[model samples]
Every structure is written in structure tokens, then in C-alpha cells.
Target: MSALTGTTRLARLVLRRDRIRLAIWILGTPLLGYALAGSVASIYPGQEARLGYATTSASSLVARAFNGPIHGTDLGAVVVAETYVTLALIVALLSTFAVTRHTRQNEETGRAELLGANVVGRYAPLTAALLVIVAANTLAAVLLAVALAGAGLPLAGSVAAAAAIGGVGVAFTAIAAVTAQLSVTARGANALAAATVGLAFVLRAAGDVLGEQSADGTRVRSAWPSWISPLGWGNQVRAFDGERWWVLALPVALLLVGVALAYALAERRDQGAGLIAPRRGPATAAPRLLSPAGLAWRMQRGTLLGWAVGVAVLGFSMGIAGDEFNDMIDANPAAAEAINAMGGGADLINAYLAAMLGLFALTIGAYVVQALLRVRGDEADGVLEAALATAVSRTRWLGTQVLAATLGAVALLLVAGVTTGLGYGIVTGDPLGQAVELGGAALLRLPALLVIAGVVTAIFGLLPRWSVVLSWTALLVFLLLGQLGAVLELPQAALNVSPYTHVPAVPAVDPAALPLVVLAAVAAALLAVGVAAFRHRDVPS
Candidate 1:
């Protein structure tokens, strides 16, 4: 039998298994583009208005770093400026997760092994996963091009942008395949792949920031940095600036390189093994490991470290750019107006900081949910039954895990505040005051974070089977409303559905404690009910 003999069957099986998942990922970017295109057109109103906004943005340090060069003053280009970077990230992440799920994840769960024992070929799983991603990404590109054109953008530019966006997905899909062959477990593979995506973002940002126009409007380091990164290549598509069709060639080359490397690595490894060896564990358990809480900490410590480092780096990087961003805004009245408008027009830095703080809390909330969901995985693996066979009650066993997650959240929250503040302080020479102010901003998110944790806890206790899907969906909803809804000018009632809507935007508002109290009360109620439910449920419940 050939190594790819069963690839077509496996590819169909993958599509069948992930039909809904694939549809959701493919449709999402187009919908987001539509919403953003409509909003930018409506909000900016006229050509002069849009151009002025672009000029000021092009001159700002932070804007350029985050959004890349504004190719033109046209609304279509403005849409690219605002949505391309965000959309690229979404597609890359979707590609990464999809490939990981079908490849390394299936292997870890023993599904691939079972299939291998049958008629499947050696390379069928990987070949099938790649084919599925290619089809899905192509579908997404066509949909987004149509959606953008429908939203009143130039058809050619829209199609070009969609291709560029899809290119990001293709490149990441291949990268994930490479990562899948390198790590011993799905979790390790995902961590490595996610870190690569993040580094791509950083490289793009650094390249763009260094390349922003000088005071007199001359170009500066952008070409070298951008040329080195696939994410940056998407921006070079320059959709509205006569469309740089050649830039689309870059990701194609990367896809070939990544695919070749992944295939080579996969061929060298066994069905259930990876090119990288696993780390050795200690021969004996420490005293702390004897307790459930200690065990929970041990399980989650590595995850916490990764999140901590990533967030800290982001905060510090933002801080480093703060002074230049503010100074540029001050020098350009048009830029200041736009920045103020986006931030509700008061202490732009603080307002921006507060928004980031809230979003960071959401990231921590996501961590909390992931930590709790691990319990479900353990239960399914019969780890829960084995542990429960001892003195550990279900409540005690789960409670320790919950407590560990909460502590991790608190730690992340603090880190976000300190790093952002430290960055701002270094720029403004007001370290102490910045720390106090920004640290308080982090504290303000406690209630909302707790609410998310409690709601996820209830889902886990009451609906373990649906916990993973429902919990993640809740976070996605909140993110869409808070980030994209504001841009789309969504109805106030719809926006109010997110708990973060009520969390004071800080520095913009003094932040009332009543809302916090009510949110905490709600969280407590949910947690209590969940605990009670778990108490009466069967083992593995």
C-alpha cells in the first residue's frame, strides 16, 4: 500500500467530522470584513474625512505598528488598515487549531492509531488534514471577496485582500503541520505553533513601526522587517494602492517550504512519536504534590508561564511606543481628534489602557475556562475515577482546581497592569503614578473575570459534555461584541449583553462599585449552584 493510499477517504472523513467547525471558521472573516467595511464608511462619511484620518494615522507610531501602512485614503483602504491585521490573526489561529486538532490531537487521543491499524496509509492523516484546510481556506477567500465587494469596496481590491488574507491561513496551516510533527503531545504542539503566530505579529509590528513615515514624510526600516515575515506580506498586498499582486507570491513559497519540512519530519517519526523528545520528570513527588491543590498547580504551571510571558511582552511593547504615539497625536490635531473619538475623547492613553485591561481580563478568563475544561478531559480519561477512589471528594478535587485557576487569573491580571504601567512610566518619567493608576485598572476587571469563571464553572458542573463548546462560545461572543460591535455601531441593547460592557472603561469614568458588587453576587450564585450540582452527580460528573 502507498503512504497516501487512503488519503482521499480520510480527507472526506475529516470534512464530515468538522463540517460545522469548518463553516464557522470560513464564514467568520467575511462577516467581520463586512461589518468593518460598513462601519468605516459610515463613520468617516466623506473622502476628505477619510483621507485626513488616514494621514494622521499614518503619522502615528502606535497606529502604524498595529495596522501597517495605510495604502490609500479611500474607504476600501481604510477598511484594510483596520481589519487586515485582525483578520489575518483570526485566520491564522483558525488554521493552526484546525490542523492541530486533525493531526497531533487525534494521535494523542489514539484515534489515528486505530485508523492506522485498518487500511489507512502512513501519510494519509497529514495529507487529509492539509487538503481539508486548503479547501476550507479557498472557500473562505471566495466568500470574503464577495462580501467585501457587496460592502461597496472595489471588486479587484477586495478579491486581492481576500487572497492575501487566505494566504495567511495557508502559511499557518503548513506551519501547524510542522509543529505537529515536532512536539510529543497536542498541547505542546499547540503552544509552539501559537508562540510562532505571536512572534510573527511582533515581527510585523516592529517592522511597521520602524518603517512609519518620518516627520517630513520619508520612509524608514519597514521593507527589511516586513520582507522577513509572512504576516507582514499580507499587508504588502496593498489592496487599494493598485494591488501588489506579487506580494501574494511570498506566502506560496512559505507554504511549500513548510510542507516540505513537515513531510520530512513526519517521515522520520513513528505514528505516536515526535521529532522532539519529552522532558524527564522527577523520580519522587514533593510534599506539595501530595495535595490536590498542589497537583492542580503542577498541571497548570506551564500554561500560566506562557500566558504571563506573552501578555507581559505585549504590555511592555505597547508602553515603549506610548510616548511616540502621544507626541504624534499632539502634533497632529486631526490624529488627536480621531484617537479621542475612538477613546471617547478623554485622556486617550488611559482610555486605551483601560480597554486593553478589560480585554486582558478576558484572556485570563479564557485561561480559567481552559483550566477547568481539563477536568473534563481527566474525567473522560478515568483519571478522575482513580483519584476519587482515595480520600478526595469530588467537590474537594474540583475546588482545588478552581482555586488554582482563580489564582492564575489574579496573577495574570496583575502582570498586565504592571507591565503596561511600567512601559508607560518609562516613557513619561512617572513610574510610580503610572503604576498606581494602571494597576487599579487591572483590579477593576476582577468582578467581570470572576463572573466569567463562575459561569464556566456552572457549565462544567451542569453540562460537562457541552462545557468546552459553550464556554468558548461565550468568550467569542463577548469578544465580538466588545471589539467589533463598537466599530460596527451595534445596538446598545446588543452590546449590553456582554458583562464587560458594564465594567467601567476606567479613566473615562470613575468606575462605580455597585456594578462590581452586583456582578460578584451573580458570580457567587452561579458558583454555589454549580458546587451543589456537582455534589449529587455521579463519579466523572
Candidate 2:
């Protein structure tokens, strides 16, 4: 059989395996764009209103960091500016997970060995994975363009924006492909890919923040910084204001170069091995390192550090953003009300800090999910069984991972809170006070986070096979509810599903004792049930 013999079959298999996942990615991006554009049109109906909003956003460094430059006062440009960065991020993430799931994850699970024993080509699995991602991006682009135009955006701009978003997804797919070849473990591969995405975001944010704009507000930013980063290229497309179509070429070029490199590296390495070999461990395993808790820590340290750095940087930068945000709220009444609602009180700065903590609390869920899911990971790899072979009881072995996840979560939350306080305090001329307030604000959301962590723990213990899926699905639901529930006009019941909704936006309002106590009780009960279930179940091979 030819080297690409089973490519078509594998492609079909991938489609079957990821049907729900693909639907989520392909549909979610365009739908969000539609929602954002429709909301922009509704909220800022008049040109003057839109222009005022744009001007306020332009002056705020925080706005510029998150959303790219605004080119025109037209509704189209407003939508593009508001949605492009966030959409690109979502698409990039979709592509990253899709590739990593099919390629690296399969190999790590030993499924690739079974497939390779058949008529499958050596490269067919990777090829099939890329093809699926490419198809998903293509469909998303078409759907996004249609959705935008259907929503009354200009046709040319709609197509340009959709295509640009697709470019991000495609480029990340190639990046993931390369990273998969380098890392022996799926987690390592995901880390490397995630790091690339993080760097791209920072580079783009830096470029937009530092770039000197010409008087016309015509030249949005310094294109040089954007030129170096693949994700940044999507924003430069200038979809509504004389499209810079040349920018899309960057990701295309990256896809080609990255794939070629991946293939070459694959050729040089043996199946089931990484391009770079892992280092030899200590001649003797340390007694301290042999415990389950120690092992969990060892597995989690890198991830903890990575997340801490990102959150700290975000907090510090947001703290500095207070000056501009204050100026912004003074000029925009709409912004002030929004901040007021989130927890900054009548003082817009405090409201901004309160909002940041809430948002940061949501982001922390990603880490919590990853940490707790180590239970499922260990089980899948038979590590749990081997560890259980010792004098360790099942509950104790599993409890170590749960404990690590909880304690690690607390540490990360404090880091985020303290950093937010420090950054906001220093910028606002009251470092100590702001730090205490914001740090408390961060801790305010702990009960909510614990509920989430407990939910994941419960899922792992009770539904070993479905744990990863159900737990992550819950996390997504909570995240969407916290971030977009109000704007989407979701039902009270839906909003109540997320524990975060119960946590008071601190500093803006006084902390309430009742909600936290109730949330804690729920989490404790769920975790206990999950642990109990795990004890009696047979371990799946």
C-alpha cells in the first residue's frame, strides 16, 4: 500500500470522533461574531454614539491591548475592532486542540501503534488530522462571512474578516503539528503549543501599545511587531478599512514551513518517540518523590508557573490601565455603568478591579480543570494501578491528586489577587490598600472555584470514561455564563448554574457570607460523593 493509503479513512474517522467538537468550533466562532456585531449595532445605534465609544476605547491602553485598533467610525469597523482579537484567539485554540487531540494524544495513548500495524501510512494520521482542521477552518470562514453579511455588514469586509480569522486557525494547526513531533507526551505538546499562542498574543498587544499612530488614525499601528507573530497578522487585515490582504500570507507561509519541518523531524525520529529525547532520571527514586502528592506536584509545577506568569502580567498591566479607564468612564457613561455593575463601586477604578477579579476567577478554571484531570490521565496510562500496587490505598492515592489540585488552585488564585492589587495600587497611588482589597476580591471567588474543582473531582470519581468530557463541558458552561450571560439575556436558571454568579463582585459591594457558605457545602458534598464512587469502581485498562 502507498504511504497515504489510509489517509481518507483516517480523515473520516477523525470526523466521526470529533463531530460534536467540530460543530462547537466551526459554529461557535461565527455565532459569537454575529452576537457581537448585532449588539454593537443595537447599543451604539447612532454614528456619534459609536464614534464616542471608539474614541474612549482608543485612549485606553487596556482596550488597545485586548482589542486591536479601530480604523473608521463605521459600524463595520467597530465590530471588526471589538471581535477580531477574541475571535482569532478562539479559532487558534480550536485548531490547537484539534491537532493535538488527533495526533499527539493518540500516540501517547498507544492507539497509533494499533493503527500503524494495519495498512496505514506512517504519516497518514498527522496528514488526516491537518486535513480535518483545514476543513473546519474553511467551513468556519464561509459561515462567518455569511453570518456577518446576513447581519448587514459590508460584503467585502465580512469576507476579509472571516478569512483572516480562519488564517489563525490554520496557522495554529501547523504550529501544533510541529510541536506534536517534538514532545513525547501529549501534555508537553499542548504546553508548547499554548506557549506559542501566548507569545503571539503578547507580541501583538505590545506592538499595538507601542506603535506610533499617524495623525489620520488611518495607520492603525506599527506593522513590524505584527509581522513577526502569526496570530497578529489576522488583526492587520484591516477588514473594513481598505483590506491589507497581504497579511494573510504570513500564516499560509507558516503553515507550509511548519508542516515541512514537522514531516522532516518525523522522518528522523522513530514512531512513538519525540524529536528530542527525554533526559535520564536519577539513578534512584527519592523516597519523598515516590508519594502520589509529590508525583502530582512534579507533573504540575511547569503548568503552575506558566499560568502564574500570564495572570501576573495581566494583573500588572490592568493595574496600570486604571488611569486610562478612569478617563474613559468619565467620557463614556455606558462604560461607567458597566463597571459599576461589575464591582468597582461608584469609583470606576475599584469597579475595574472587581471586574478583573471576576474575569480572572473564570480564567483560573482552565488551570483547575487541567490539574484535577490528572486523575483521569494517570488512570488512562495505568500509573494509578501501578501506584496502587504498593501499600497505598486507593482513596489516599487519589486524594493526593485532589489535594494538589485544590492547594495549587488556592496558590494560583492568591497570586492573581495579590498581583492585581499590587499592580492597581501602584498605578492608582495607593499600593498597599488596593493590594488588600483586590487580593480579598480574588479570594472572594474561591468558593466558586472550589465548586468547579469539586465538580471535576466528582466527575472523575464517578464517571471515569466520561470525566474529561463532562467536566470540561461544565467549565465551558460556567465560563460563558459568567462572561456573556447578561448580554445574551440568558435565563436566571442558566445564570444560577454557575457558582460564580453567587459570588459578590467584591470592593464594589460588601462581601456576603451566605453564598460562600452554601457554595462550599455543595462542593464538599460533590467531592465526597466522587471520592466514594472512585473507591468501588474497577479501573478501566
Q: Which stretch of 10 consecutive residues in model 1 shows the poorest summed lDDT?
A: 212-221
lDDT of candidate 1 over 221-283, digit per residue (tens) = 265677777799888888876788998888888888888898899889998898899999899
Candidate 1, position 302, lDDT: 96
Clashes of 2: 2
lDDT digits (tens) for residues 1-541 of candidate 2? 7777899999999999998788877787787788778765665667766667677666556777788777767778888887888788888987998898899899888999999999998789999999999899999999999999988999999999999999999999999999999989887888789889989998888777776654644345645776687777887888888888888888888889988888888888888889867778899887868777778888888888888888888888777777677666665566566566545467677677788888888889888998888889889889888888899898888778878877877887888888888877786688888877778778878899889988998888888887877887898789777766655567889989999888888877788999999999999998898889999889876
lDDT of 2: 0.82
Worst 10 residues of 2 by lDDT: 214-223
Clashing pairs for predicted structure model 2, backbone only: 344-350, 344-351
Model 1 clashing-pair count = 0
Clashes of each: 0, 2
Give the runs in model 1 whose Cα sits over 4 Å from its true position.
212-221, 320-349, 538-541
Clashing pairs in 1: none
